[model samples]
Target: MAESEERRGLFSEEDEGDPAPDDQEGEPRTPLSPICDPSHLLHRIVVLAFMCFLGFGSYFCYDNPAALQTEVLQDMNLNTAEFMQLYAWYSWPNVVLCFLGGFLIDTVFGIRLGTIIFSLFVFGGQIVFATGAIVNHFWLMEVGRFIFGIGGESLAVAQNTYAVNWFKGKELNLVFGLQLSMARLGSTVNMNIMGWVYHEVGEVVAAGHTTLGVSLMLAAVTCLLSLFCALVLGALDKRAERILHKEQGKTGEVIKLTDVKDFPVSLWLIFIVCVGYYVAIFPFIGLGQVFFIEKFNFSPANARAVNSIVYIISAPASPVLGFMVDRVGRNVIWVLCAVVATLAAHMMLAFTFWNPWIAMSLLGLSYSLLACALWPMVAFVVPEHQLGTAYGFMQSIQNLGLALIAMAAGSILDTRGYLVLEVFFCACLCIALMAVVMLYFVDYLKGGDLNRSASERARLQKEAAAHSE
Candidate 1:
């Protein structure tokens, strides 16, 4: 009895079952009618919306310096090397801490409270950042970024957990696609609109650090919005779990640090692929504005537009590609194709002076496709209890690579020209392409399950279940 109550407390801290009071002897309880029924599609969709927005604030604030690279330099009186440290600082701690964050999400805080706490950290960190900007203290701003980093990456893990929690087997691929779309949309909105917001803030505030700080301060509003979403989503999830009498997780199965030893080679290869591929995309975008201005002589507005194309295209393409991948079920094949396309895009950027719009557009489509197929593959290989840890390790590895490469890219830009930088990005993509090939062969040896169609996988799962029975 005590163990059962403890398990119940994981979903909600309150006492035994409290009646929902939705069916008050009136007009039947359909999906839309009750609006409170945990099993209803409407409730799940609402939860998914909040899940999308959960990462919006973090994603938006993450690229602030990227969008305003010039202004950050001018306002803080820093060079390119020092400016790149902003991203490095953000990525460095996430190297180790994100894994712990995931473990805590599984063991200590569960999903709901963990999310709220992380949201608060984001909100607080942004405030500190704005204060540093207002005071014109670069170190303070870096400290703020460090704090913000604590929440940002781990919050992503929590968001992923939420998606799996509510929508695991039903439209999960589409759900992941939509989540990535929304996160990238936040980034797109930041790049396009923050410049206008900066100018607007400049009109009222002083022009230098004051204006930059004020603009950054306003970003807190988005963090606040995310916090609200986290709170409401927690409440809704708790109620849903209670009403459905779901076991949030197996009470007896606890996460252990030693369990990582059990992870297969395929999962580690995915982590490497994530690290190899994204270092090219993200660090490039971080410094892309300057590359455009110098290499192509694009005006700042045009540079911002071209630089933002990847995210803009992702907003619509992710879901469509995700739905297609779901039907096709060759996730590894999709990943391979996406990596090859990305490699081609980087090659064009390196070898030609052709219109960057074409290169960026191709890159954008390729990234959307990779995102559609890559993440959900983890769910297939990992046990349900350890999904959080697997995701955390993936994020951590990716961040470590980003931290090192972002600093290197900045230094390379400072010393060598843009051409060399493009070559470097191309090389990273090559590594990604090779990793994907290796992953494919490895999974093929393990029954070719990774490349099988959805119907085939479903049939296999049923067979395995019957065999076990």
Candidate 2:
């Protein structure tokens, strides 16, 4: 009951004052900062730049096994079934831990501490993983990956909390998109470079298998870099809290397990959309190279190269699409557009005789578009305090889907082949389209303006300006 009242109070200030009067046509007014002051806004952008690096190491290390699958198998003397355990280990624990991690952030540890602790998990896990590789202890590596997953997804939740804290309602969409773009860039970099790193290490060691451990150890170096970024970001967040005196201000309601009941129909719809859309993309990409090599008659090298086009395109374009969302504020429209594009991409892959490049590129663009526009909506519906839980729960659900669907898709591929796999992905994407359309209706019933970015920005700016006055 107290929590409900707290939440009501949190959102009740939706239009606390008449908006700051608009300037006349062709009249000049001082350009205002998005938040408390211009200096603070500048600081926020710098924080965002640091936020870009928080997940870099995790992203790089996450796909290392896939990138060097053959080398890892040979180095560990493991068959395909055993090698698959690596991903399972990374994903399984996250399904539960991410939600608890978010809960801890909101109720117990707070964002700064949660980030540092999660980052330590990432760093420590990498060290253990690298050690396992060096010792040819496959179980040890699994343990390392388990620990890494605990940190990886929870750390992502922490990053989302930080983003909402600093950027909510003012380019929040763009910020989330930028963060994802960086993470995807990290993945793309690992895919392109890990093989080279392994080759380079092999040359220096001048041995057949001895270099694999050392090459894998290089990933630990990236994790260490990520830990450093996390620490720095924590300090910045602390300083912002202190200098801005935001601690004593109106804050989010304290989170409770029962608070799940408070999540609106729109948030649930969004969650469903998140799970379905990601199941369509990430799992397919995991198996896509093989699919391409088999179905398109491409050479192994070229197939892998073409499969990478999705990440490469998304890496640079996500932030730009996010900026467009910020400017336009039609988040539902953008999300639906993304779903349509994803469906088109899947249909082309499944049924068409067109160039594969066109299909892959469309998937990339739509992936970027959905990601940027989708995440910020949580900020719109949920208050600041529970942002951690909101993001955490979404990650947990998404990871569960990723873990389950990857296995299912792989099983289907083994039995039925590429066409069947495409059908499965297309089906998930269609569900996402339906979920997104439902979101549009829910937003419309509540007041469609929530889907518009420009008015929200203006309102936030007005609130900030009025508060400053």
Candidate 3:
């Protein structure tokens, strides 16, 4: 009987020691596995489409003034110097509002509300512009342009944030490239179509018709289209929430300027590089057609068409550079772009009289290379949580450069002449070259290779493995 009792005790101990069968296998699997399944891929497509539509709206407002500058001067009875001042008025507000928009989107309102509010400003600004033009009120036109800049600057920030939300680590770089490419596509369209529109409007005004009324009507249509696209995006956001359960959840806490006290020095250098590069580029984009007209004696239509070619080339260049950044590495592509841009700038300044078409073509390629490479580098140096704020800060700096250069370029053209413009271009190129050299020094200090950083390559491999599992 004692033996039997001992055996029973042993059985009891074994039963207690054994893990539950289900526990051994694994915890009960959640039925909601694959939370971010591709079943809702259509929603992502819709969101991207809407983003492109918003892009169209922003570019239309930004590029229209350039296309219609001559007509605007005639209608407002302004001289060249006054028109240049007006252009400065239009461009400066973007610099001021970029930081505000970035902070508000990330912290206060979130993407949806931020997008809607700013879009309203865009619509309202268009209306104001139309009214000012119809009434022949030049000062009112300046007011409208300022308001439009405020709204338009936010569009880029909002769309960039949206891309990060839906596409992070999942072909994200390509999506970023596509989004930026679409924005350029919008710019190209505006440059081409606005030239025709301006010609038509000028003819109408010359025939004693009210061109402003017709232009205003067109603006109304575009604004309505933008609103409709934003609504579609809203619906897509809801669908994404259903599929992914708060699909666009906050990645992390909003990083304030104070919080960035310890941000890496390399990041600050990157910011400076971006600012100098944009300062050289954005203002030139505004003045490119004018430059062509002045330097080449091309008609307005031809000049605008030539200018559009840059963006047309850029549309493909962005995605190609993005893909290369992903495959080859970011640093390699960035350095190459900077070097190429430097060469192009020198070529343009030196050879403008050799063949204006050749100069313009090189300029276009230079713009494409720098733009595609520079913007994507933001993704590399900043933390994902801080990307929106970081980008906003970068853009703010960029706008500062743009605003100063636009004013400075115009003033130089007015006082010192076009030869001064060439000197300024050369100076800008040198600044850009210096920035690239700094980037190289930073890379060296980090013991990083420009061709291939082993750590990043390994990280990419790990990410690929995770996705596969």
Residue 349, candidate 2: Cα error in Å is 2.6
Per-prediction TM-score? 0.85, 0.75, 0.79
- When sorted by lDDT, best at the front, the candidate numbers are 1, 2, 3
Q: By TM-score, who's the top model here?
A: 1
**Candidate 3: segments with Cα more than 4 A from true spot:** 1-38, 79-81, 85-87, 164-171, 203-217, 239-253, 330-333, 336-343, 346-351, 376-389, 449-456, 459-469
The CA lDDT of each predicted structure is: 0.79, 0.73, 0.61
TM-score, model 1 to reference: 0.85
TM-score of 2: 0.75
In model 1, the worst 10-residue window by lDDT is: 1-10
Candidate 1 lDDT, tens digit per residue, 326-412? Answer: 788998999999999998998888888999999999999998788768877776787867665666567667788989998898888
lDDT of 1: 0.79
Candidates 1 and 3 compared: the better one by lDDT is 1
- State which candidate has the highest lDDT: 1
For candidate 1, give the lDDT of residue 255.
Answer: 38
